[model samples]
Target: MRRTITKFGSLAAVSMFALALAQPAQAVQAAGATGTTAASSSAFFEFTDGTDTFVFKLTDSAKIQQARNILSGVETENVGVMGKVVKTPAWYNSPWKYQIAPNSVSFFGMAMEVCDASISYVDTHLNEVGGALLPGSTWCPWQSKLTREVTAP
Candidate 1:
């Protein structure tokens, strides 16, 4: 009788331990099924055109910082004229001025390209004159761009 009682007590203790370990996993699974596994957020912004908009979805704060850095010129490419064949700077890699809003970010800048005498001439002669060819100057039309950040709801 004594041995039997001891065996039963051991089994009960093991069962309780197993139950305790399983509880957290069950709770996690339940939360995942309900789509509440993690916190989510999003941001949105519009271009200078005002009609165009962009959105970004971020899973963590690191992504938000990356977007900020990109806009802040931390990783901006140099201002240069685009060239044919070699494929001068297009839209994405160009330097842009970014603005952070309550729920979004806005980016605006001009894209430089090596055009025929028409575009370059207007830029150099009329716009530049003696001064340097400043980027996004009167010679360069507003590229008009925007970007936004988003995350799971």
Candidate 2:
């Protein structure tokens, strides 16, 4: 799928991808040599758009750190770009099962915030997602705020 890389997104993606590519062969082998699947390193962030609350599971360590900063007041921005919305149970236990696509996280500070729509709009219009509701499979609640870091089971 085509990704929307606005401003900082491109730089972040490039650097992360480059870092993945630069990993030493030995390191890769050592990871696989264990014969065990990597333990789930996923982190969940619970956010609210005033009325509704939702959670996003982030597997990228960098993105997790960004969320931490936002929650700690270190980051002044309150808006963030969410990943594609899926029709499956959320990574955490909640009435809202829909979640942002994994690894598609982008922090605040963008001219065009695709996920600036409301949570109700996105939930009720799941059928229209990717076409009209949230173009490019991105969702950014304009007033989204990180309430807390959810402990993943």
Candidate 3:
């Protein structure tokens, strides 16, 4: 029994060594990662709902402009990337909302209306950004996405 146990241990060591040699270098770097990824300042919004925060990373100029328009209440139509639906899900021609599984979300609007209207307020203020109907809101500071591509030595 002792001899069999020793042999099995040796075989396990050899298999581990072989597996390590066959693995890609990327896995090693990732495992040894001492760095982290960051967000960019190219134009992104930080949304908050008291409990959680959402970061919308805007890249495309048109989409960014659409977001701007939506915020400004001058957007022609609410379609595709122009909707106020802020979920970090990249689908269709737009990126997804960057929130962490937000459910029971409420938009800013008036009473007696199925959907409240931040539109009227946005139309006047244009640069106004808050969610009265949606409890609380906050403008997050600039942040960067971490780029942790490491060089394995």
Candidate 4:
């Protein structure tokens, strides 16, 4: 079930208030997590305009970081462009948060914020991620995480 927090509480309710605030924060990380499975093992991002598609295959953390820098305007050069992944979406990934690079992603050669619908779709497909991201490592932003999906026991 969903939860919420309330305000205007008396001193006697300090502990309860704290707990309420903490609950939502703790749950946010898992908000859209439907679970994960090892569908793909590489890191990549895909963009499509329905008729045509583009793929940017990322080899290592540096390239991924470069892309992030480009989005944040930290890097003046577009050195983040790695090898072309493919003309059509063709990877399979699990449904989970793969820690996408920070900043608005690309679409049809335009720079704009990625829609939640795209994030959700790509996250689940990873393999055929229609648009958005492929499987991303946790080690991003300066480190890495295994891009493999988590399976239920």
C-alpha local distance difference test of each model = 0.38, 0.72, 0.37, 0.36
Give each model a TM-score.
Answer: 0.26, 0.69, 0.24, 0.25
62-125 in candidate 3: lDDT tens per residue?
A: 5445556655567534421112433234332122232222222222222233222232232333
Candidate number with the higher lDDT (2 or 4): 2
lDDT of 1 at 29: 88
Off by over 4 Å in 4: 1-42, 47-53, 79-89, 92-153
Please give the RMSD of candidate 3 to the true structure.
16.7
Candidate 2 lDDT by residue in tens digits, 49-145: 8898887788877778788888888888644545667766664736665667776777765536655777777777777878866787677776777
Task: Tell me, by lDDT, which candidate is best.
Answer: 2
**Which is better, 2 or 4, measured by TM-score?**
2
lDDT head-to-head 1 vs 4, winner: 1
Candidate 4 structure quality by residue, lDDT tens digits, 1-153? 122233434544998889999987666546537453222223455433333233334434554555555555566533222121222333332223332332222222222232222333434555543334422211111111112122221
Runs with alpha carbons beyond 4 Å of true place in candidate 2: 1-40, 78-81, 91-93, 111-114
- lDDT at 107 for candidate 3? 28
Ranking by TM-score: 2, 1, 4, 3
By summed lDDT, which 10 consecutive residues of candidate 4 come out lowest? 137-146
Name the better of 1 and 2 by lDDT.
Answer: 2
